[model samples]
Target: MAERKAALNRAPARPELKERLERAKTIVLTEEQMQEQRASFAYGNAPRNSRITKASATSATKRIRLSDPQPVT
Candidate 1:
């Protein structure tokens, strides 16, 4: 439609994003830092004492079961 074409021709939502990305600095993490980052994401923001290990994470999910489906009217 003509409206769709006009919308596509408009400027991007973030016109300065390209320049901002070009000016941004890149970080290089050491091996140990990378491992820590991975662990943080895997375990989320859980407390240290309650955080589950990777093995436990899989096992915990395995215990979950979906409820029986209800028939539609």
Candidate 2:
């Protein structure tokens, strides 16, 4: 109980994820930017047989699609 109380008292000065997101939440899309991003995400550029359902995680190691930024397939 004493350790738990100390941990709570020394808890973060602010919510950590919220603090990180505050700096990183600047991805608002202009219409042109939205169109460009959508256009870039498909066709032969994407990985073949590349998808991640919940089951894929359990079977074995998975391939990382480093070729695609924010890899979509």
Off by over 4 Å in 1: 1-24, 45-51, 54-73
Q: Residue 38 deviation, candidate 1, in Å? A: 0.4
Error of 1 at 50 (Å): 9.1
Residues 12-68 of candidate 1 have per-residue lDDT tens digits of 678589766655434444545445555556577556888588656545544544354
Clashing pairs in 2: none
Cα TM-score per model: 0.31, 0.28
lDDT for each residue of candidate 2 in 1-73, tens digit (9 for 90 to 100): 8768776765566788887777656545454444444445443254667674334432222232223233222
Error of 2 at 56 (Å): 32
- Clashes within 3 Å, all models in order: 0, 0
